[model samples]
Target chain A: MKKLINNPSDVVNEQLLGLAAAHPELHLSLAPRYVCRKDIPQGKVAVVSGGGSGHDPLHCGYVGFGMLDGACPGEIFTSPTPDQMYECAKHVDRGAGVLFIVKNYTGDVLNFETSAELCKMDGIQVQCILIDDDVAVKGGGHTSGRRGVGLTVLAEKIVGAAAQAGYSLGACADLCRRINQNGRSMGVALSSCIIPEAGETTFLLDNDEIELGIGIHGEQGVERRCMASVDILVELMVEHIFSDPEYVRVAREMNSASGEWEDVQLVSTPFSRGESFIVLVNGMGGTPPGELYGVYRKFAELCDEKGVSIKRNLVGTYISSLEMQGCSITMLRADDEMVRLWDARAVTPGLCFPSCDDVTSCGTSNAD
Target chain B: MLTKKNVLIWFEKSADAMAEHKQELHLLDAAIGDGDHGINMNRGFGKLALELPVMGAMTLQEIFKHAGMVLLSTVGGASGPLYGTLFLKGAATVGTSEALDASAVLTFFDAGVEGLVARGRTEENDKTMYDVWAPVLREYELCLEAEMEFVEILAACVCAAEVGMKATIPMLARKGRASYLGERSIGHQDPGATSSYYLINALYESIRE
Candidate 1:
């Protein structure tokens, strides 16, 4: 409850205004509340992703060169309405098409699906890819399957790069699905974060306990256990990600031919013994970078021990859940193409590459 | 008698009831959900309350459609689309009818539940509003088969909804945010189901008044 804000209801609005002011490359639309890249290239597939507001530097931070073309933020921990997404997509589409990258929560999935439908009705080609990389819950649960966490940032980066490279809408969507399938994430929370509107934490944990397999939102994790050392925690999380069975589930894909949703079964290939990985040691907001590096230190050692080569690694707060004190580890099986895409230069408010001089010359950026 | 005016009254009463129970719903949601069910529901209905004056001149189908559109635009969550779909699909069933008979009411409920099922992909035991709505539809059909009057059938449906809402207390959540709690989701009444019960009860009360 003790946070710096004027009012609980205006938190998202005020934060969005600040984000818009800070990031001049992004254009903010107030009526529908979406942020889009100001200088979008012509004839390139547009990449859009969004969800609740608490997971900052995610959909919005990824909205620049070689990443998201637009993002629609909703209320805290609530999915954005379809109208906002529809309007955002309409404005961002540059005559090629728009691809929606959605996390696999029920509200997000439902809202994104509705938005895609609306866009299609308005004569815009739309494709949606659902990200469900969290290893906490089994597939086909009473609720939606796994929640999309850190891997969402990875997907946005890779797919955004693909779109920037002039990949077709179908190609971008396929790459997104591949990234989603190859990634697995596991998280543990030392404490819960308070939601601004609720004025309380979603859950409580004792000083001696931690919740395992926690989602990005302040929701309870799959299990609770006595607190362990950082190395032990990293070992446990790495093992869970490595040992998870091949994920199989049914997802909705847009049937461009008939303009309806078609049921498509997707399978996530399990990690092999000698596969290479793009690893991310992500903080859940409250954790410091020093501690995150502590997680990566043990994580890298464990990967080396398991014969899994770390092709690339990002250790920081790429995605977060309010100010919850926790960290999640994401491992995406990376090939040469994925590694190359991961290294692509990007500039946004949340992520920036100072070495990249001109955004227009990079990739398929055409000055329009 | 279920006239167009009665339908408008039903919506007004439903909005009022949701506003009254807003805090209670938020408390229930705090236990297992993100704690915005009451806030979102009240916001949706509050918009409907504002539109009621303008909606008074529309046909039953138009009124329901307007209500659905308002909820879809104003309520920014899972319930927005789910409840909005319910009203939109229900409006489709009413077609050009000026008022509703028992059979027409049954048709509306059937379509509303179907829309909810299609949107949410929830089954009977998913611990959602479907649990309440499915029973209400079934009980209304039975009441209609017994040649009950429109108000009596509505009363019966409201009673069924109450029972269904209470039944959600011991059920494990299989859908929505509460499902993340797994077994811990049990013992708390579902906020969506509770709001649905109030909506149906408000319908009956509007007719009685």
Candidate 2:
């Protein structure tokens, strides 16, 4: 119940204000509450994404060059309202168009869908792509579908790079869809974190137990088990993700041509040997890097044992569950194009790639 | 007939109900979903309670639309968009009239429920707010077909919503965050359905006279 704060209700707004002040590169709109790049290059397809506020260094932190053009943040652990998304898209959309990268949560899906409809009504071209990359939730008729976790970070970076490279809205959306279908994530929680509003931990775990397949929002995971060695835990998570059966789920997407929403069947193929991946071993805000590296050390060895290649690796607390003590592992199988885009130059508060090092790779060598 | 004052009273009562039961809703959600349903619903409805008085000079249609936008702007969750759309789409069924007859009430709920279904992509048994909304709309239709008074129809809706809310205790959630629990989601009443019941019940209490 005790944490540093003036008022619980004003937490989100104050955080946004502080972030806006710290990051001069972003344009912060307090009324509708969205953060977009101060200067989106004219005619570039605007990439926008948003969700609840707890997962920091995510939607907003990723708002910058070669990432997202804009991000709408909602209350802690709550989805942003449609007006936030609508206003953000409107602010960021240049003459080209706007692409909405939505996670597959019901709140995110509903709010973003409504916002897209509103944006389209204003004659702003828009396309929404949903990210569902968590392998923990079994995909079926009687489930909420898989939750979008760590892969959202990857999708934003790759899709953001493509958009920055002057890809069409359709092309950027297609790349995002491909990334979602190719990635899977699983997380484990040593303990749950307290929500500021509730002033209590979300769930209780015995001293000798941990929750497996934990969600990012402090929801209960699929299973609880006695504490085990890091090696065993990491291997178990890796196996669950690598051997997940063909996942099929129906997602609602907007059909730009007909201006109506349509159910699109999305499938994620199981992982195989010899595949390359961009892997992320993320912390849940509480875990320190020393421990994260230990987890990654075991994970990297496991991938090598399985004959899979880690083309690029990121180890940090990029997305979190507000001081929850846990970590998630995300692995995205990347094709050549995806790999190339992943390396494209970009700069943001949470993620950074200096273009000063490489010239032609970012296509900046051409006459501007 | 249901007047704009009755509608405003419904919102005010809903705000009070959510505040009174905030802890209860939070407990229900904590069992299977994130423990914020109570806080979220209370925040949105409480805001509406404050915002409703300002609509005194407006028509019923304008009131509903303005209320929807306020909820849409303030409530930050699945319920925000769903409940917000319920009002916005229902406003489409209402005209500039400050008073609505029984048929108008039926038409309004029918459109509102349809919007909830579309927005939530939920079926009747999905263990969502639509679970309560679906049965309430059906009860409204039955009451109207039976040539009942507006008060009678509201009573039927309140009862139907209670039954629907209780029915969710055994449902395996097929939508929203609770569905992530799989079978673990059973044995608890849905928070969304519970909140929805309060809303419908509040309407009956508001216009009991």
* Residue A308, model 1: Cα distance from true site in angstroms: 1.1
| CA-lDDT, candidates in order | 0.87, 0.88
Off by over 4 Å in 1: A353-368
Isolated chain A: TM-score per model? 0.95, 0.95
Q: For residues B1-209, could you state the per-residue lDDT of candidate 1 as single tens digits?
A: 67878888888998999999999998998887877889889998998999988998898899988988788877777888888888988999988988888798778879988988988889987899999999999998898899988889888988899999999999999898888777889999999999999999989998887
Clash pairs, model 2 backbone: none
> What DockQ number belongs to candidate 1?
0.68
* TM-score against truth, every candidate: 0.94, 0.94
lDDT of 2 at A208: 97
True contacts kept of each: 0.60, 0.90
Number of backbone collisions per candidate: 2, 0
- True-structure lDDT of candidate 1: 0.87
